[model samples]
Target: MGDTRWLSAEEMRAWNAFLAASALLNRQLEQQLKDDSGLSHPQYEILVRLSAAPDGELRMTELANGLINSKSGLTYQVTQLEKAGLVRRRTCPTDVRGVYAVLTDAGRRRLEEAAPGHVAAVRAHLIDVLTPEQITAVADGLGEVTARLRALGR
Candidate 1:
């Protein structure tokens, strides 16, 4: 190797901050969701996605992609939801190989119950702690990073 470039001190600080914030936020939100509605974070997200879809459903592949989760992981979560009467999986008529995850009425009600606590936790832990400029900076910076990573097909 001819040369190597490592993160600068400032860059290291930024990276560490990001890692810590994301991990802590995820943990807190997960706990809130579990305690408030007996739903895991991923399950709640699945319900939210389906509830917003045209027919309260989406193909399994599409749901996995949108969630940035592994197909197997999504499958397990969907299965759990199905058993709980919160969701159902149906084969697509036009495409036998495709499966759709549909939110049940119970799922929607669970989401409505979970959302308030989740949003409040998010606000208390992150949003309300930031100034308007910091909020904008975070949104723009993270959005750009997410877009770039997605563009790379990762």
Candidate 2:
């Protein structure tokens, strides 16, 4: 291994704060989603992604990639959604080996019902706490990190 470079006190403080905030935010969001919509945060995210896709559908591989989930995990989530009548699997017309997760009418309705409460929770926990400038700074800083990670093929 190469020589380890330690973080400075300031850097460590910021890093820890980021970690704690991330964990707490996710926990809160998950709890809120579960309580309000009987859905987990990951499930909500899956629905959100499908809702935004063209024709409210995405190939299983594409959905898994976008969600950063393992194939099996994505399949399981899709199965759960399917059981709930929120989504259905369709065979890809152009690719016999591929499957698509298509959001059902019920899925769209569920998402619509969940969105308001989710947005309110987000605003209450994060957005309402930050000034406009701070929000922009946070977005820009995270966008930079995301770009760097993607560049590294992470």
- TM-score quality measure for candidate 1: 0.97
- In candidate 2, list every pair of residues with a backbone clash: none
Report how far residue 102 has shifted in candidate 1, in Å: 0.4
lDDT of 2 by residue, 1-154 (tens): 3788889999999899899999999999999999999998989999999999999999999999899888999999899999999999999888899999999999999999999999999999999999999999999999999889878975
Using lDDT as the measure, the top candidate is 2
**On residues 1-154, what C-alpha lDDT tens digit does candidate 1 reach at each position?**
4576788999999999999999999999999899999999999899999999988999999999999999999999999999999999999999989999999999888888888988999899999999999999999999999999999997
Candidate 2 TM-score over all chains jointly: 0.94
RMSD of 2: 1.4
In model 1, pairs of residues that clash are: none
RMSD in angstroms, all models? Answer: 1.0, 1.4
